[model samples]
Target: MIARSTFSNGIVLCCRSDDDDSLLAVKCIDIDECPTSSLVLLQHEVALTRTISHENIHTYSSVWLSKSRLCMSSLFMDYGSCADIISSHFKHGLPEKIMALILYEILTALSYLRSVNLIHRGVRCSHILVSKNGEIKLSGHRNMIELSRDGIPVKKVHDFPKHDSSMLPWLSPEILQQDMQGYCTKSDIYSLGITACELANGYAPFTDMPSTQMLLEKLNGTIPFMLDETTVAPLIEDTSPSANADTEKFKSEMIEAAKSRKFSTAMHQLVTDCLERDPDMRMDADQLLKHPVFRQIKGLSKCQILQPVFEKMDPISKKASARVFQEQEEMMDELNRMSMCDVEWDFQE
Candidate 1:
């Protein structure tokens, strides 16, 4: 191994392989000597990542399992998560232009996933990885499903493992029922809306709610979207999802909550389109990508969009990338703490 760092969780080590001062590969290890469920999940992640590729998606190169540990090698990402930037640099929100570009990049990836009939079951702000080059990409393939060949996502809520419970706030109403409905790309569109809110306000709408309450809120369409106080609140967050809070204060509080990163009407509109309660009503990735907010990015190269984000990262991103070699799990924790950033984490090529 070129470099390695192990975690106390079931996950073992994650490292960057380097050659001639450029990234060669990213290796992930899962220590499951007892043949556990987590081992299967790790293997699934490896296979899924290896199968999918887009300029904005992390790429897996190879995978193999030893007697006890499962190892996966993929492209390295120097930027950690957009959460790091929100926590550190834009606690209130991100600029409309940057958020627009980032969402555009993600939709590009999502469009590719849809073409293959896949549902990125989990698409949250925390899963969005960035690089110092300002390139934004998505990770967390742990819960994805290939609907093309598989027919439908795993049935029964029991089939979903506990580790992914944190993602409930992003699940669509149809998927939250006791009798699960077939989750498709539209389900992901709902998540993309929540992620947009998280991107705008630095936290998901229901972060403080208990897990069960969050589930009910999502099921009943009670959650809000892009409710930042400083920026223009999307009209839909008020109308569509059944409102549970004092709409006046919910509106006033967000208006009062520190609005550090003001965005635009086009970005807000994009979030509204994705947040449409009816799965049938939601815009697919391809449709949302065509919205006007993304028009600002039409002629620009991916690198051009990323350059500003790279320049905006704080020093914490550099330290976190380095520390990933010392404590992979801790580094992950740091990403949530809003203390890290990433540089061009792609392979040398």
Candidate 2:
């Protein structure tokens, strides 16, 4: 008999499974309690996970309905999540190499998803799972949106509830504005950039401010808590007065090395690119994978790892992607044009 631990949303412990065994995370979803639309979305996620099997992407083990509960099958990750790591080690950021490896794995997974026309709408650091062996897996595939269904153009669903803008400052402006067509592979890239920032700082950008205030600031084109001389100095300086000046200089150099304009090594650049007011200029997963920083990572693979749960097309997702895509394109174009004009106008003013 399997022992159950916690229960919520129809999800409970089926058996006394430790973190070691090759068991799966089984969520018992209640179709009756959940919106019919959401149930369909959950099924799609299961199908998608099962279809795509890769080292970087979380594997879906099985799916079954028992009585009134819909059970989902997913690989159980023992190391918890990236968020857990950050919270535990908030005093010091992770090593650059380790961070690089994590990002590379995520990018690889995203590339595979994009290749199959899937978009992981949620790519935050918390969503990333690390194995005991340091391998990374991108979990939370339930939020992914498929671009095409069968041969016919699928209708996109735009009625999903809006998420709090504060929780994810790294999200593309298009997504925040609810432009479904404008949301694309690029949206995930933006989230990835934010995740990188979180990894480096051990805190979400603009974490000090209220979400409402942060949202307004972001809308105004100002990024909160960007690393400047003051912030960088304190973060690097050793408290010991006996510390050598040369060591200090080296520390400064290390911080500088982490800075960039291309979303390569510098979390700042990635933030800039992904959070650019314009979506058109934002880099997609393929473009991001080609970046020098991502290219140099070792043990990275180019193979497609995961597949969709349902081979059959969902009309809601297709329509949503197209609508969000077009809206995002227009918004981006406008934002870019306005930014250029502002730069020139500021000089004149």
Best by TM-score: 1
lDDT of 1 by residue, 83-201 (tens): 76777767656766677878888888899988876778788887787765667788878787676533554322223434667788777776766354455677788888888888877
User: Which of the numbered candidates is closest to the native, going by highest lDDT?
Assistant: 1
TM-score of each: 0.73, 0.63
Candidate lDDT (C-alpha), each: 0.67, 0.60
- Predicted candidate 1: what Cα RMSD to the true structure? 11.3
* Number of backbone collisions per candidate: 16, 27
Q: TM-score of predicted model 2?
A: 0.63
lDDT of 2: 0.60
lDDT of 2 by residue, 1-349 (tens): 1213122245533322465564445667677777766666677677777778777998656677788887765655544577766566432344444566677779889888877777787788777876444567998666677765564434332322243333356565556666556456666776787777777656566665676776677667664333433356555565654257865664565466445312333544555665665667778776766665644454544221111101222222243457778999999999877755456434565
Give lDDT for model 1.
0.67
TM-score of 1: 0.73
The runs of at least 3 residues in candidate 1 whose Cα sits more than 4 Å from the true structure, single-residue gaps closed, are 1-21, 24-27, 33-35, 65-68, 148-163, 178-180, 228-262, 301-308, 312-349
